[model samples]
Target: MQIPLSQPDITQKEIDAVTEVMTSGTLSIGSRILEFEQKVAAICQRRYAVGVSSGTAGLHAAMVAAGIGPGDEVITTPFSFVASANCILYVGAKPVFVDINTKTLNIDTTLVEAAITPRTKAIVAVEAFGHPGGMVEIEQIARRNELILIEDCCEGFGGFAGDRPIGSFGRAGVFGFYPNKQITTGEGGMIVTDDDRFADVCRALRNQGREGMAWLAHQRLGYNYRLSEIQAAIGSVQCDRLEEILENRRRVAQMYMTRLLDNRFLILPTITDDVHMSWFVFVVRLNDLFGPTERDEIIKGLRASGVGSNNYFPPIHLQPYIAGPYGFKEGDFPRCEFVAGRTLALPFYGKMTELQVDHVVAVLNEQLEKVQMVRKPRI
Candidate 1:
């Protein structure tokens, strides 16, 4: 069986919702978008939500709403999807790379305070792999520094940091609805915030700077980042079944954990006591003995065996675009680079079966042994 890396858990309910929207003449900026935004806001425990074309768009809008512009600096981890850092760049601001906590794979809050400079305007904290680790600490640090906090909840839609929902800790938080996420709208996102003014700004930003249904009047420069009615209609249905979707994902995650927890060569995802995770991808790290080369070989072997696998992330700082311009070297963020080198993402989805999970584990174990034997030749 060829187990794919990720799949959307779509049902007839979502199809019916999409069909209803298609039948309706009004497609964009309609009631479906409004309803979807409301549902997302409620889920994040925020007063408002602005639907956008993608999570990247939501983050860019949040950065713009926060007045982050030229000469400003936004601190974020290097061990995340590039969008987290790219949003800072979209506004002509610099993104200061930080290392991640080895355990949670999120930004190391302990080091955040030290990264703050006078030019530091905001902290773009990403809930990496849907784990809300160190978010509370990051919030406290941001408050102390008087910096804006933008929570990248792109992978953390249904998670919590202690008693608070994932989006509530920041001035603005964004959720992505990519196919691989816990819930999907094909390609859409939501920006959530309690700040009324910020919400208005994001809403306008997503709709070509038109304020309050003014279609042609442009107040400021903006992008066409609006989420479509069809996407929102599907999203609304997904939101209605959010609990069921999250529970299904959690169940699949547990299955992986139960099967792989005893493996000596791998380090599984860590969930802190105070935080509730919304599992996005099941990523495991090869032990310190395994380097990027070995990890890549293992991934290759897994794929060769019909088990889907991939390196979850490569350090964003080391990417050619960022590294060359910013003068970032390999050792700039050791912890992040270390973790990025060995991290492996396995096939994960709400509907993934136990047999599939077992097959993936078996393939992974076989690959690990092969790499190990090659590294240490028989004497």
Candidate 2:
């Protein structure tokens, strides 16, 4: 039974692509990287794409390219992967936290404008759990305030906000290809943008600040964030199969929904009509009657029963690194904290079978019922 939380779908095609690159003489900054970047850019409907070593590198490069430095403020949601906020810190800028929408789990657009200030420089909007909700309003807010919009599309590759792709909404969008993501490059990321100068800056930032592939010339201080040829080759093949992968993920998502939709004790993911969701980790939340203690117990019970589960995110603002320095405490972002407390990411992947899904659901229900018996007053 031991269903793992998440897995990557890799085929023989991807294996062959990696093998070809490994045999090729050029390993770094080669044609494979160019092909991968081109495929990503076209998919995002952007004119340029820069391949980087990781999603964190891509976001940091975007912040630098946008001229976000010390004393500047970047607004973002606390209910996201820590990198979404950590990227702001990398550029020596302050990350101004905003609460997220309870249902969508993305940053609440209503609170975004209020968070903007004279020093506000950018908005790092995340597609939480791969749902591109409220991005249109966030884009409008950024535009009206003249703020740089860096879409953190790390969890959202094939998603769309209305008719437009997820990466098309921001000034520069970043995608990650970790092992657990929709696609994997072992470890890599891509920055997509229509702005020529921004694209050029990111390209330089990933290659030791070299301008136009000069071997020894360094234009500015930069980190070594270049993606290797082998990773790029794998990414290129993954890009070719992106649509099929997404469809498979969607199918699994539907299976989970069909099985769990009637559970009164759990709250399933909310997918709005306007956005086409790219399924990442399928997370479910315990109802209001259940607190963090109950949620933890359920997760532990599921794990003990050979079903993998985890809290999708702990609030970024409450993390010691951010909280100690910024003086952030509990209740700063009530909505985010509330949702984060109960959220549980279950086993999810494109190749997951119906029997595995059934096992996970059964374990979850058994755990929920056990928790309910112990806390009868809340029920």
Candidate 3:
């Protein structure tokens, strides 16, 4: 009955791909990396893709390659992993925190325009927890502002809005190949873009500013963020099965919704009608009825019952680094900060079975019942 919150769906294909790369001896900047790049680009319908060490590297490269540097401000949501904001600081650029929509939990397109200024260079919008983040509206904002946009597709690869994938909407969309992503590359990332200039910049930045191949001449100073052939090979193999993985994840999401339908003490994650939602995580927000301290108690109960659950992220601005020196505080992004303390991610992955899913939900309901009983006196 024990269920993990997230698990990589690795199989024999990943093994075979890695073995082939190991035997080739051309591990770094080899054919495998090239192959994986092509596949990743094709998935997003982008003309080019450059593989890198991780999604963080992909975001950093995107920001730098787009000519964003000291004093430039990148508008982004505070309701995501720290890496999203940290990438902005890597280029010596400032990350301007913006609010997120309460329902979709993605950066609010309505709030983005007000945040942009003359120094505003790009927008790094995360497709938080696999929802596509309403790319259509976001793109319109980008077009109007003439801002470079980097879709942080780390949690949202394989997700589309009205046929265009999330990453393809922006100048450069980045994907995470971390173990739990829709497809894993054992800690790798890809930058997909239709703009040839951006693509060249990404490729150069990933390999220490080399225009072509590792041994080639350097044009600008860059870091060694290239992905190994072994990782790319694994990514390419995983890429082939992406559709199947998305289907499985969708099925799991539906099961969770059905099971938790009548639970008034918790708010289910919301998905917009525009999204295909490649279900990366199922976030459940604790309702006020659970009382002030009940969310923490429910997590403990879920763990004791062996159902994996945890919060997705804390608000980026509220992090100590940004809060102390950058002058960010609780009331800054009220919705994001509020959600951060209440939302919990439940067990979700492509490989989970119906029985496993049911067990997780059954545990959630039982825990809620316990909380209600304990808090009845207060009510």
Candidate 4:
């Protein structure tokens, strides 16, 4: 009866795609990878897509192709996975940390401009948990200040803002095909863009800097970050079922909302009126009204009840890796630091059953009662 945090919804279609690749004896890169790139580009409405080794590699390649080098700084939020900041460092540029809007968990666009310096070269914004950031405002700022904008859409594949798709709003957008993401290919990622020259640079950098169409031409520095046709086949197959995947996730999220609708003490997530969510990971925050003790207790109790649960993130700023190096102490980014401590990620996958949702909610309520009893003064 244990509910795992996430599981890929692989189907016969996925197996057949992989079988076709194996049967062809072209297991590396060829037609399948090409088709994957085409399909992803079409999904994002971009002119090109390059399949890379992983999301980290896609981000690193985007930085390199965009000419982010030493002595430069890239402005980004500190509430995401480390790769967002590490990509800047991969190209010898420093990551300038910005705080996030506690609600959306997205970068605070209002604070972006003051962080810009003569050394700042780019803005790397992540669409946290499959929700688009305030891209319109971010884009306006980038254009006025003359900076490269990279959309870290690793968690927001099918998400959009208004009539525009997320990744297409910036100079380049990166996505991951890791198992927990919108789609799965075991291990894969992509870089999408409307600029042909940037796409060519990335393709060259992925292989071995061989701009020459022939395999032997080594024109610039590069790495072996190409995705195998096996993975490409899986990505193509999964891409075909993405709409179903997204719909299932969305439905599960709605169920949780209806079941766990607590107005007084639990801050349930609500998708903003216009922004569409891909529902990568359903999350909730404990309001202060619940008191400080309930947060950790509820998370522990949920796990004990066979309901898989984990914290959203520990704020990249406070992470041990960056804390000392960047001189980030507790109060640096209050919202990010506070949310990191109280937010919990509940189990909400495409295959989770309604009964499991009920069990999870019950466990949470029991924990809240236990914590309240502990805080009550003895009469």
lDDT of the candidates, in the order given: 0.92, 0.93, 0.86, 0.86
Worst-scoring 10-residue span by lDDT in model 1: 206-215
Tell me the TM-score of each prediction against the true structure.
Answer: 0.98, 0.99, 0.96, 0.96
Badly placed stretches (over 4 Å) of model 1 are: none
Candidate 1 positional error at 75, Å: 0.8
What lDDT tens digits, residue by residue, belong to model 4 across residues 24-127? 98998699999999999998999999999899999999999999999999999888888888898788888898888877788898899999999999999998
Model 1 lDDT tens row, 288-341: 988999999999999998888889899999999999999999999999999999
lDDT of 3 by residue, 32-70 (tens): 888889988888899999999999999999988889999
Between candidates 2 and 3, name the one with more favorable lDDT: 2
Which residue window of length 10 is worst by lDDT in model 2? 206-215
In order, how many clashes per candidate? 0, 0, 0, 0
lDDT for model 1 comes to 0.92
Sequence-dependent TM-score of model 2: 0.99
TM-score-wise, the better of 1 and 4 is 1
What TM value does model 4 have? Answer: 0.96
lDDT of 2 by residue, 251-307 (tens): 999999999999999899987788798898999999999999999999999999988
Residue 194 in model 3: shift from native, Å?
A: 0.8
